[model samples]
Target: MTTMIKTVDVTTALSDVDRFCDIPNARISGEIFHRQDIYEQELEKVFARCWLFVAHESQFKKAGDYIATTMGEDDVIVVRQKDGSHRAFINACPHRGNKVCFSESGNARGFICNYHGWSFDIAGNLIGQHESGIYENSHFDASKWGLREVALIDSYKGLLFANFDADAPSLKEYLGPMAWYFDALFDNQEGGTEFVGGCIRSTMDCNWKIAAENFVGDILHAGWTHDSAARAMLGGAVAKVSDFDESYSVNWHGHGYEFAMDTVGNVAVLGESALNKYLHTIKPSVAERLGDFRSNMIGSVSSATIFPNFSFLPGQNTIRVWQPRGPNKIELYTWVLVNKSAPEEIKEKWRKGAMMTFSPTGVFEMDDGENWEYCTKTARGKVTAKQDLYVGLGQESLLQETDLPANVYSGQLNEANSRAFYQFWSDLLKAPSWNDVPNRNVGRVEAGAAAERCSLKEAK
Candidate 1:
């Protein structure tokens, strides 16, 4: 039986959404994190319409190779065709609605339905049927019965994404100023970066936003939350330094970043010979291409979130996609990123670092997972859910429009980014379309001028 969801008054929700901008130093109500109705609303208003990261193009290297991925809760299969082009569509077979391909990843010229012998080409055309006579003289056009395609699909520097809303902005436009930072991380090297093998998949009993917010906004927790792990990995001076505060910045469209000094020198953790070799290989090239500031960040520790649900810590060489299963659960897809032109030994070391720091078995992952689960459990309580949670760490200190690149933050410990994320989140849940977002909250101050400089209108 289908459960009926009562329609929320969009106008009333719009008022609530606009209020988030004014509540700079206030706590957000905890109810937003646990309500089932709100989660349902998010599925339609946010997830369905947003440009979600699907998979890297490198994942589909050869023609016929494909990987099953998720956009919101919808299952999609991304395939590389004989012509070396790519396509993505709902994984369901049109005839019987059965999942056409069950494997997580593989190579296939076409997907054959297991229930009935209906088959679809990698391009999503229903080309074959077991019993052609079943339809007889009936007017059935196989062309009209092709697998459903995602309304909007595009890529950015090899990363593919799809949106259910056709009117949504192009992927590049949606990425906005975040692209500058992405180019810093991805395009600095000659061949750029590529995912190593497949992702490490795991499930967490926590709200998806909890994990995303942690990556995007909660740098303060690193020292305390991962104290034991940091101590175990690098003892004495490194452990002591890890306890110190860091600096953070918030970008428009809810993207944010937190940067910290090398608590342990790069040479100490990555080995002297290896660090020397890496510097020798990239220093001259980096200086020639991106200048000193970006080249310097190559080995530093930085965690960042790209609006909505994609995040990466380039210094750690880790990338994550948070797939919300429901309000109380999330499926995390983690990939190890390696400089495409790095020496095999260096790439291997980077992979090991990623596994040790963020994989499901990693010490830090265990620490954060426990906290995420506890947060969700606490929110389940009637009294607790009624209260609000604070995220106003350095609201007064947030950088207003300045000469620095887009909302350049002054400190590493501010909650300005977290607040920006929630502000966008609330706006998304309320507005009927992405175009309506700017007008609904026009007077609201945007800390990072990044959005204005890299307008989504130009992404296409």
Candidate 2:
């Protein structure tokens, strides 16, 4: 059952979205990350309209295993059903504003509200209550008061996603050619990928988009921000500093991926472990399944963001969600995704490696959070908010001349993906309804073609 979501009116925020992101000029105002008005509009335009990743299917190994997570500002519950299928619902209790499930995640047959004894079954059905309840009217039907279900829920491979809008496109449609890249990372494993560790939650003083955009194509910072960690690990003063090649891709609907041209630099963990051996072992099988293009990415170090907030490091085996808390803060949820058939030692190595590099206590993670915090904090100044940040690193160069699903750039350090990301954000805000979202699914091709023409003109 779909219930209407209550949202704050955002008339001014809609107008500001277009003003903040001027793609042709290569400018995005500082206010987009600092202002409360734009944040409110984002919840309506971006979060509500887009299909957001919720929980991985591997998280629920048995019936009734559920993960309580956040979709946007709203709380959500994703539960494995009696059958193998999965369903997601708003975690809010329908009777009152009280929570039905207090824990973040666990196995549960049913959820009983602590404030009142009103209970709901695993399928979100109103099962019991009324022995001592106030709404005990004999004629009133309690069965009709089930928990509010999300309008749409679907899976791509093993990843589950949910959308609030009933009119939004299907998951496969929204994913588009981005699915091709996903298969390279996810479908390559023999037994497939599964979350092998617990979650690590932390909050940082930064806009959600800042972190999301960084993973897309901001590899330039690795050498600078993670200089110390790189020296300690790779014995090099610079992080991921490669003499070989690297590439960036901007898939439709703002999804992105970047990987080094060489695979060794991406997965330079300890000397030679089972993970390294596993990488070599899977290449032939992956090549047969996905052909030469995708199999190249089997064990390569790559960073990607699935549109809005979901991100994963394929080499590191870390997956994360940058959950938006407000204009200036985000609650980050991280988990380890490892090969299903891997041995216990290999899985443990991946888990511990993620903790050392990407978790809250991670050395590299600490460096990144510091940069993002200051990036957001500095924009709080009135004059700073008026400034236009430059995001035009390879703006004149065309990255679309490719047979792959995503538009590929020559260099990994380019900001082409960031440009596509902000444009997608602004377009979603400018659209009055999902029907009016012209810049999304169908427009990316035309946009790429236009970029190609502009590049040719510049060369002439």
Candidate 3:
């Protein structure tokens, strides 16, 4: 039996998401980018169920250190406790729904609500309130009035993530094979990675998915869209995509990455010679530890998105999350990441270099913002919203003769990753519960295992 879920759309009234997605044909409707009702459903079905990036362990060195961030539109405060464990809670006060914390981050003994003076301990337990004698006659119990705690929280390689859905899989399980690729960037260094400075936030008049899907695998846009910026920084355009013999666009489940074998192409875009030289000096040791496959990727021309909205540029070392502000707008939060073992000078170079190319006011960022904003703004028309946008550029280019995990397409210019991303998006939107959502990568993983076993037997 097939379960058909109807999703709301501005153009078609109520319709199945499959009609809009059209995975086999590689087409999708524009209404998915600008519909208010669809965006509301995504909040409940996608944002609330995913393992969203919240904060990094480097941000909290001692008890009570905390940073206030968002998972979807719901404001949350992730705090370190006395026991050295981390926890997160809703940023709103239990009394009258007032915001408790105003600062972005700080070390505090407790959070006090300005509206009614209700106070909560670092662990989210209600400890005090204004005029205790006044509440003595009421049914208010301090023990039961604590701030609502986030359902689940976990970490991977110093990055902390929180989940609102208790029924969702553990973070490790949720990451699945994507963890294999992440280990190269995050865990390859001896001392691991850390954020360099306070986050820089900016707003864009575009849907979050437009920004996300770009990072996911739209390498085709780089050569044309950012050509001027690339020429300014690197003294030439980004790598030519028509000759993609050594490049791939790979997707695992919903996560996607596109990269080329030009080991220093992305680093060169930062226009910092010291940083580029630094990567070369460390490549041999990385190869010894994680093997050539991941080691060669250390300073490669690559970009990735971890489903829904988090994205990063590997060699440029810019990490960001696109928090959906509304159906047609997003708030982008960005940070520069560097290896903790790096020298002070090298880390400083990384901070400035990344900002020069990817920050809100950077040359590359300016080009992207205009493109995505127009992509969202023009989709608002009734006739324009009904048209299907073509995403089927390289449907016939699937590559299987490789050890790469997940779905690997042969060229950097392919839309395979974008197609895989939308398929997963539709799957999430149409499923009633997590149980109904399918793991689309299972067969690819199994087939890879089978191929590996065959080669091993032949070697004997």
Best by lDDT: 3
| Runs in model 3 lying further than 4 Å from the true structure | 1-15, 446-460
Query: Which residue pairs come into collision in candidate 2?
Result: none
TM-score of 2: 0.91
- Candidate 1 per-residue lDDT over residues 1-460, each given as its tens digit: 1111123223324335433233455567666667787777777877777888888877877988998988878898888878877777888887779999898899998888988888888788888788877765688778878788777778887778878777777787676655665655677777767888578999998988888888886777876787667666666434333354644464657777766544223333433346446755676676456554455545555677887789887556678998989888999999977778887877777778767778898878899999998898888888887776888877777566543344556666777778778877877876877767753224443333543343332232
lDDT of each: 0.71, 0.77, 0.83
What lDDT is obtained when candidate 1 is compared to the true structure?
0.71
TM-score of each: 0.87, 0.91, 0.93
> What's model 2's overall lDDT?
0.77
- CA error at residue 33 for candidate 3, angstroms: 0.9
* Candidate 3 TM-score to native: 0.93
Clashes of each: 8, 0, 0
